[model samples]
Target: MKKIMFTGGGSAGHVTANLALIPYFRQENWSIHYIGSVSGIERKLIEELPDVRYWPISTGKLRRYLDWNNVKDPFKVVGGLLQAYRIIRKEKPNVVFSKGGFVSVPVVIGAWLNRVPVLIHESDMTPGLANRIALPFASGICTTFPETTKSTTPGKSRYIGPVIRDELLQGKAERGRELCGFRRDKPVLLIMGGSLGARRINEAIRKQLSPLTSRFQIVHLCGKGGVETKLESNNYRQFEYVNDELPHLLASADMVISRAGSNSIFEFLALRKPMLLIPLTKGQSRGDQILNAESFRKLGYAEVLPEEQLTPDSLLERTMDLYGNRERYKETMKAFDPGNGIKQIRDWITTIMK
Candidate 1:
């Protein structure tokens, strides 16, 4: 049996992409193993799935600036790499795939050192630092945007779009409404700040609650650390997280207010939902999300809001504007969707084995 090891973590962005690969991997009878940090949010989601083994690694964050915290990162990385190496040796996988994140570095490095063919799927328009360093060593690199190819050397990179779950590709709107107990008579708006949640976006929405609730029925997936208080009106349902019923909520929505994470963008595109995207900028990866937002906005797919400009008034205005011009917004984004990527990814992997 062909064996493969996968690594990525931190948010649902990383975890969802990994989930996209599992069904296809299993059908081919490939033995699969996962390597992620013990404390990563992804652990809880994928742990119960059978035939998949999860390995924990000691992960450390790499600060973008010079700081005392930088001193301890190398040690942590070394330890994680050692743990990854042990898992790789024991599993003896034929290949390794990584969705770039801090948790993935050690696994990527371990696979490279062991001479295993390693492939990386990068989800942002601007590749992360770990991805930038790992690209030259990876046997193949897949990205979600055309602009991303410029960051890496040619011949090794290809654009495969974002990897999204199968349910989003099918119709999700009707089911989303049913699951949330929302009425289809009114417009449904989805507010998401990734899996862990975004404080700024949540706060802005909170400030505008009175006006927003009056106009729309909303489903807010606030990050785990978000304020979980109700708006006390009949128009909204708040959750620290929602895992099982995303397709319904996304498909049933008239509009979405979300972060410009690559994974989130693909979800909107798959469902063809009009969106107002707020890219992270405050100590958020040195304009990484800013680049993702800019790329999509340039294509007329979504409106981009920088962190400094994301106030209640700004969000409300943009929300109303997009809601008013729904036809033009939908027309402008006709070419942005890249159908479900699972079959494409599955084909690519099987080709390698052949």
Candidate 2:
């Protein structure tokens, strides 16, 4: 069997697209190996897969800010590079697939130095610092949006859209209703703020829960350590996190309230779910979420409510607006093509290996 090494992870976003390709690669009978930070969310997630081998390496986050860690991280990056280089030399995988994160930088460099081809995927409108650093080493880069093409090396990049999990579209609304304990009267509103929930959005939802629950039942995916048992209503259900039930919850919902992460927004677009997006501000991120939201709004797939205006009133008002304009939003999403990039991506992986 041929061999492939996958490297990506600072967050679940970096790993999920790779996950979408895993089962397909398994069916094709390839030896799969993953290189990631020893303690990253990626190791926890990828370790659960039955057939893949996981390799841990040192990694330091790439921060754009003036962080104290800046003094120490370069050494870690160097250490990671050495570890990755050793792994690549030993494994001799035919190709390396990266999903663009700090951990990916060392792996990409190691693969390139070892005479292996690298394929990178960037899910954001703008390339993260890690991907920018790794670009010179990659053989090709796949992007989630057309706008991202201009940000990459001209000929090396292509707009292939996102790799959405097939199971997401298989969701059953009846199953969702049963899980959320819905009585079938009010519409369901699913609120998610990435893998780790957004405190601002969570607070706004709880503060306006009384009024909001009157019109719609809520299925809140409030990341780990975010559940609140003190405030409970029959119309509102809160879970710290979700995995299997996510598709059903998404399918059952009339609309979404979310952060503007590219992977998530594209998933919502694929499901034709109208969204009220509250993007992360500059203080929190490099403003990619803001750009992602603006693009979605411009495309008529969603409405944006800036973080500065994330009060209970604003959130509820925007949600009401999303609900009112849902059909128009759904129509826009229906017309969108996030591309069947998974097949193309899989083909590229095997072809590159060959």
For model 1, the local distance difference test gives 0.81
Q: Tell me the tens digit of each residue's lDDT in model 2 across 95-176.
A: 9999988999999999999989999998999998899999999899999888999988989998888889988999999899
Clashes of each: 6, 0
Consecutive 10-residue window with the lowest summed lDDT within model 2: 345-354
Estimate candidate 2's alpha-carbon lDDT, on a 0 to 1 scale: 0.90
Q: Which stretches of candidate 2 lie over 4 Å from their true place?
A: none
Please name the candidate that would achieve the greatest lDDT relative to the true structure: 2
- What TM-score number comes out for model 1? 0.94
lDDT tens readout by residue for model 1, 70-174:
999889999999999888888888888888888888898888888887888888887888887777768877878877888887888878877878766666677
Best by TM-score: 2
